[model samples]
Each structure stands twice: as C-alpha cells, then as structure tokens.
Target: MSLTPSSSTAPAAADPLTPLLTELESALGSVQAALSQRDALALERHAASVQRLMTDALREGRERGRGGDLTPALRQRLAAAGAQVAAQRAALGRATAALDRAIDVLMPPEPLGLYGQSGRTLRQRSSGDVASA
Candidate 1:
C-alpha cells in the first residue's frame, strides 16, 4: 500500500505485513539478485502482488458485516493465492540453494579459504555437536 515500509524506518520503513512481509521481501531480493547474474535464467521472479491484493480485498470484505458474499469469495481467492505463494517460495529457496552450490563450484578455493581457516576445511559435523555443546 505505502511505498515506504514505515514512517520511522526513514532508512528501512516497515510494511503493514510486518515480520512475515519483511522475510518475504528478503526472500524476493535474493531471488532477484540471483537472476541478475549468470548467462541463462534459472530462477523465477515472483512479486507479492497476489498476497497484497488478497490482503486488501480481505480488508474490504470485513467492512461488509454478516452474510456477505465478499467474504466467501475472498476466502476462495486467498486459498488459491496461498498455494501459489508456498510453491513460489519453495522454488525460490531451491533455486537459491542451487545458485549457492554453483557459486561454490565456480569460485576456486582461496588459500585462506572462505572464512580464513585454511587447514580446517569447512564441514558440517553431526547433530551430536549441538547436543554435546
């Protein structure tokens, strides 16, 4: 609705959607960035337009009290939109992971390694490490 995320976020305003909306923004940005590079497109660009539209429509539906067709119609549309949102987010995640792996494959290992622990090859230990700690 508002171009600015929030009034006080002078730098980073808040969206009415709040945290979930914020996370959604972050996820979308990642997808966009990943698409910006590479010779061929391997990712999808999805906007939160559907969710925003449904949210706005739902708000309007609430204005009309009991026995309103708007509510049911909104519900049906929202159900479909929700499914799309889930699928898009899942695909974006997969694409992002694939991009990361691709980047790792493309970038040669630095002498000091990524985070500077040269001898210690970064590897994931078992879940036991968490419990042990």
Candidate 2:
C-alpha cells in the first residue's frame, strides 16, 4: 500500500537483473568457444545475443537503482565476465586480421596495363602502318 519498496519487494525487483547477468556470462562463454573453434557464424550469433543481454542489463540496472545494492559476489562475477569477453574480442580481431592477410596472399591484385618485352607499355598501332613481311 506504500510507494516505498519494502525489503521483500526489493529482492524481487533485483531478481530480473540477476538472470540478465547470468545470460550475459553464458553468452560470453559461447562467444569464447566459437572463437576457439574459429566458427565465424556461431561467433556472430553469440555476439548479437551478448549485445542484447548487455543492453537489457544496463536498462534494468538503471531502473533498479532505487531498489537495492547488488551483492559483492555478483559484482565480482560481472567484472570477471566482462574481462573475459574483452580478451576474447581481442583474440577475434587478431584472427580476422590473419584471415584477411591469407586471403590477400591467395588472391593478389591484377596488373593494370599490358607490357612489352622491354617492360614498357605497348602502344596501339594505326591501320595506316604497313607490316614488314
């Protein structure tokens, strides 16, 4: 009947945020596994899920600011999860760069113009020029 949150209601309010945090951690793990396997498709899917979870978590946290404080254990777990995600992201970047280099090596750029035996650009001949048979 009161506008203020009772102790009992506080826990219930914080409950939603907990699952978001858990989902984020799980998504990070999936991302790491995908990266290890070099599965780009799976990595992209997991990354998108992680992003969604993060946005939801941030919004929930802000809304619950008036509810209560997060437990120290949860805070620590969140920090560890975030660090793991960052490390995996750096690894992904390196892997992508290596892949790009490999592709470049396999498919080199084409030359622009035709060259002569003397290494000079060949000029087009006019129809009026006669051939020395």
| Top candidate, metric lDDT | 2
Whole-model lDDT per candidate: 0.48, 0.71
Candidate 1 residue-wise lDDT, 75-129, digit = tens: 4544554665676668657966886677557654556544576332442222223
- Listed per model in order, the count of residue pairs whose N, CA or C atoms clash below 3 Å is 4, 0
lDDT of 2 by residue, 1-133 (tens): 5646586787767588688888898998899888889888999999999889877876766566556566666667666766877888788789878876775576444355534333222222321223611
Task: Write down the TM-score of every candidate.
Answer: 0.42, 0.65
Residue 68's C-alpha lDDT in candidate 2?
59
Which runs in model 2 stand beyond 4 Å of their true positions? 1-14, 64-68, 114-133
